[model samples]
Target: MKQGVLLIAVLTLNGCSSISPQECEVGDWFAIGKTDGQQGIASSKFRSYQKECAEHGLGSDFKAYEQGHAEGVLLYCTYDAGRELGQSGGAYNKVCTGALEPTFRLGYDRGRKWYQAESALLNLQKTLEQNAGTIEKLEQRIDDNTRELSVLKDKQQKQNLLDENRNLLQDLRQLNQMQGQLQRDLKQAELQFSLIQQGG
Candidate 1:
């Protein structure tokens, strides 16, 4: 009893036993002493811890609770020493085993899972958006290729028409040359007959 009182006094001087009567505030440590019992700690210290934990960041609250866990573990070990090895009066439970522990644990697990799922869904949406952009670019490329191919076909048709026109012009020139040669040959033959008549 003397050692427990001395420990509580020392902790109180160290600012670990700060308790608010009206409401639990943030950034405060809640302490449970066997002398004060679990009821007092639950009502005061646990409320303060929970309020701070909820209002603060995850890592922040975990860091804050680390001190409390350490204190509790120390108290547990202190009591265990008495019941097993030596005589010292304090809480000896291996764990705090609070009433709200189970409920809070379940809620934390659910919240963590929900956040993970939300994160996955957000990532999936981003991936899908990127894939959609890639598909759009590919479609644009295909359309451009199709337009280029159409232009090439049109150019080929025009070239084929030009070649056909050139072949027809060549044929027309050959015909004109043959007609001129025939006319010249006829004139020469006519001249030769005229010369024969004259001779006769």
Candidate 2:
């Protein structure tokens, strides 16, 4: 059976690879692009990441989403690396390797620092926790603001004192005019509300 390939090779660098298309297809995926020690997904970096993840024991059986997340983390790293290179003015100059093909030079030239797979896993967990905390705090703040706004609205609505008082008086007058038990009940309710509003 043919090994399935998922690499998204960039057209600009496709011709630069010594690997036959068949050999390239054997890998799960390759997001190809010439990262100018300044931008894009440079080849060497991605291969190093593949090795990093493999070393981390992310295991070969993971699903697409897990793999995608891993990829996302790596992508974030790649983007940041590219930005740093851009600012440094080619502090890490691009080096064309594989004389037959010139891969867009990109990567951390500093001694490679791969977090132990355990540390990487922990970092992901911490990120999730921090995100969750941030969401909860925001939600609580929103709810508090909503409650405060409602109180403010109630007070502001009171500014129409003439109209509202007029309405309340009219309602009371109507209730007063009602016969018997219902009238007594309405008056009692009005008295209770007045007491509460007046802070007893």
Candidate 3:
């Protein structure tokens, strides 16, 4: 029963970890650490690997892993890497230090502004599209109601239709106002995005 429980625990840990059971068996700690560092993964990630490997009765080489990670992190902590990451809306882990941190952060900040401007423009465009679609639907509904009212014989039903048309017309006016506001917002957003694209 104890062995079965241990096996289950190992399996569960392996499932949660990116490191496979086969990787634990092979025990290439340095390479794993290097890959993680190059990807800007946190130092705490090593502890997770330790735990997963320990569950499988394997030993990890911390010294070798740390050495490899130090070298790999140099490659990750670059201006180009930071710019690409920020442009893609990736989160920074604050892994870079000292002089490296400043350079990377400068690129990251610039790219982040561009990304935000682009995102704002896209959101405004989407809202404008939705507003236009709603306005079109409201107009269609009002027209249909008007047509039905023209040929109606029941007085009570005709009154209900008239009331509904009034509400629909009010809604349509509000939606048109919203559409105009969205268009103005979209134009501003587009101008901001264009400025960012031009490196302003």
Candidate 4:
């Protein structure tokens, strides 16, 4: 108990020395700590605040801050909150401890994975759609060229049209290959995402 008290005192002192002028005057340390905790900010921020306040000849209210931080952490450390943060690609602040930490971490990990997979799937599908659009344009060009080739009296122009058609066909083939690969990737990502959602 003595050691713990010493540690707390040290932390308080370290955080108390750097208080900002505004914070010193406002003296709303509890609200500041609560906001910090809700935003998943590090506890070290208090130390910085302490220093800022100290420069203004003010002291930090460590006890009020701690009480508010605990209350804010309860809101932040929920499983749903963890999942939302992870899905949004936010980093863990590691403020939670004990049993709650494990559960929140589990949600974060799964949510992050799920978010990544979902994003991948969306990108693949979009690429596939773009490839399809390209293919459609290519087909239109091919048809137009074929018709033009048939009606053309000049041999040179007909040959040129034939060559263009061949090139279009080649591009179409490559796009088809890309579309197939994207479809496969989307399928795999979807499966993984589904599994994560179900398992979690």
- State the C-alpha lDDT per candidate: 0.43, 0.40, 0.78, 0.76
Residues 1-200 of candidate 4 have per-residue lDDT tens digits of 34334443444565544444654666666766666677666566777777777877888887877877877787778787788778887887588888669878877887798788778888888888888999999999999999888789999999999999999999999989888888888888889888877976
**Candidate 1 local lDDT, 1-200, one digit each (tens):** 44435545654564654333212322233233332332123223445545544554321233444555555544443322223221112232224346534443343444444444444445555555554555455455545555555666577765665565556556555655554554555455555545533532
Candidate 4 global TM-score: 0.75
* Candidates sorted by lDDT, best first: 3, 4, 1, 2
Location of the lowest summed lDDT over 10 successive residues in candidate 1: 85-94
Give the number of the best model, judged by lDDT: 3
Q: Which stretches of candidate 1 lie over 4 Å from their true place?
A: 1-100, 153-200
The residue pairs that clash in candidate 1, if any, are none
Could you tell me every candidate's TM-score relative to the true structure? 0.30, 0.21, 0.84, 0.75
Candidate 2's TM-score reads 0.21
lDDT tens digits, residue span 43-80, model 3: 67878878877888887888877876787788898888
Q: What clash count goes with each model?
A: 0, 3, 0, 15
Off by over 4 Å in 4: 1-24, 47-59
Write model 2 residue lDDT over 115-144, tens digit each, in one string: 122233445455555545554554555455
lDDT of 3 at 138: 84
